[model samples]
Target: MTRTYRTLDVPVRGGDLRVGVWEDGTPGAPTVVAVHGVTASHLAWQLVAEALPGVRIVAPDLRGRGRSNELSGPAGMAAHADDLAAVFAHLDIPAGLVVGHSMGAFVSLAFAHRHPGLLARLLLVDGGLPLATPPGLSGDELVAAILGPTAERLSMRFPDVAAYLALWRAHPAFAADWTPELEEYLAYDLVPDGGGSLRPATSYRTTLEDTVDLNTGTAVTDALAALGHPTRFLTVPRGLQNEAPGLYSPEHAARLVATYPAVRHERWDDLNHYTVVMSEPGARGVAAVIREELSALG
Candidate 1:
């Protein structure tokens, strides 16, 4: 399919926020608004978008990330969700499927809660459920584990985009699954910081705040329980490489299914949190689940 890109500026809480949209398939076809995870931009949906023919796919760079970094806001889930709502209103897209991955899952949940009538279905790709942090783990410690690489990268001034892309390609998380699509997705996350240096578009402060929000799971879990729309939760079997077991386990996912009887839960055994949405195979699996769910909804 031939894909087209466009920029959208929608009014939000404090000011206007920019959204990068990838439009493909048919104009009047059912739309799927994809929300990417923390530290990721709209490009994260590239593989999924390519697989879903006959559907209008819209993936937006959330506030403080990608082209929307300049967008003023609180840099929390509610703020991101509100930004999505604004986009829907501006485009006059009513009642379409909502798909979210990781932090994007939280944003999707929040949107479903705030604007119940606006979503036809909600599909969470290995995220959106409550995650349990070790009780003794301090917020700072958690942030360090999660944002350490980003901090290190943002501190160094990359000589050029190629240099930055080289570093990303060598990263362990993506070492085995690197592809041209993944390269383009990573590129979207980079921006010229200053002095002819490139840096990630997401700010350290926003990254930390997003971490705290995910660790707490306050808004997301509550929103899931309250959401009236049909919802699907996809869980990754392998936890973070450095973390203890049960951090994001199948048991936890089962409990979530029990709590929200309306939620359809599934687990992908071979993928980790990052790979679940980053690789072609993982993205294809997620797309299949989404297709099934949306078909059932129809």
Candidate 2:
């Protein structure tokens, strides 16, 4: 069965935050809130939604990205977490599971910390844990080292959505994973730049702020130190460009799991960071994990 997809503007701090809702049309079905990675929109979870026909997925265009790009104020993990609280309040979601990918995973950590009662369990995909970065690096250096081309693309201007799609189609990570769904996800990232060209909807400054907050700010560190919820983390063997070791090196992933002994951890050897939730195979794996968690909840 084809699940239904829709979007709505949920009122938040600066402006309305655009949220995507994917549902199976089964009344009272289990709902799961999904959070996209940095520089990505709610559409990143579309594949996962399709894979789980029995589930309802709620994802938001975080402030400073996607339709929420117009939202005012500085971006931080705490601010994003609070905005998530607003999302739950507006939707009247008392509590349920949350799946966060990349920066979304970091936001989920802060969200679980700030609004503990709102998250029953957390499924962190390739994020939420402290990244092992070199010391003595400036904020710009940190963003560059960690994000590389992902951050660079935010400053680029394209003549149209096609140009943007072309850029993504050329990405090494999507070389063998390209699909119409991936095309739609990339196309949604473009917005008019006011100069007749189109640019990615993610704001560079917002990305920087968020990058710094997640990597350097004490909120995530503190959250990690005080984690009390049932959490599961999934790491990919490859990264944004399909490079090996991905976000967390095997040793790093193992160390994190050891550090947070209570948090369940797994490494998906075949998928890259982006594909873990964006591609069909990756979505099937994630949907399976979500189903396991939901069944456990019951």
Candidate 3:
């Protein structure tokens, strides 16, 4: 089924938020608010949108990425959660399902904690559980370790969008699975950096702030402790670079499940952090899980 893709700017406290709405031209379908990863835009969920036909997908370019880059932010999990709530309010969503990927999952947890009555069910893809940091790493080291190339690419400059594509083509994550959707998502990430160059719109500083808070601060921690919404969590064995063990190691994931009994965790060995929602098979798997979770709730 061909989906209608519409871009809109929803007014928030900081300013307007750029959102991507995908649906089958149906007016009253169930809405799923999708929040993207730390440095990613809403387009990251294209495959998921396509896989879930008839579902109204509301994906927002969070505070400092894509077109929302201009919004001056007090950026963090709670802040992004508030921004999502604002989008839901503007769309007249009293209570809805939310699908969050990577850091977006943490934001969703914060959202559920802050706005308890607004979320009926929650899905966390490749993240949201408390991350187990190595003992020796400090702030910058930990951020660099966690994000790797996803963080490094922000400061790099390219002569053209094609050059940026070339770099992404070489990336371990998208090398084999590159699709038109993924290409468009990468293309939308670029903004002019002067000198006939292009750079990612994701603010490095803002990403750093979010990384610190979500990893160590009280907002997400406190929220996780009190998260009462029925939640589904999916994770992969690979990291952003398509390397093994991903964000949550097997041991860490085990600890997480033991700690948060409400979060139903599942693992897909074939997918990575980026591929879990962006790629075809991964999206279909997630969409099925979402459908099953929703159906079970009824």
lDDT for each candidate structure = 0.77, 0.92, 0.89
Q: Count the backbone clashes (under 3 Å) in each candidate.
A: 0, 0, 0
Highest TM-score, which number?
A: 2
Which of the numbered candidates is closest to the native, going by highest lDDT?
2
Report per-prediction Cα RMSD to one decimal.
2.4, 0.9, 1.3
Runs of candidate 2 with Cα error greater than 4 angstroms are none
Residue 99 lDDT, candidate 3, scale 0-100: 87
TM-score of each: 0.90, 0.98, 0.97
lDDT of 3 at 242: 91
Q: Taking the tens digit of each residue's C-alpha lDDT, what string does model 1 give over 117-213?
A: 8888989886787765565566667777555564556556676778889988777667678889888877777888777878888887787787787
lDDT of 2 by residue, 106-203 (tens): 99999999999997889999999989899888888999988999999999999988888888888999888999999898889999999999999998
lDDT of 3: 0.89
- Candidate 2 has its poorest 10 consecutive residues by lDDT at 22-31
Off by over 4 Å in 1: 25-27, 136-138, 145-154, 239-247
Clashing pairs in 1: none
Residue 260 in candidate 2, Cα distance off native in Å: 0.8
TM-score of 3: 0.97
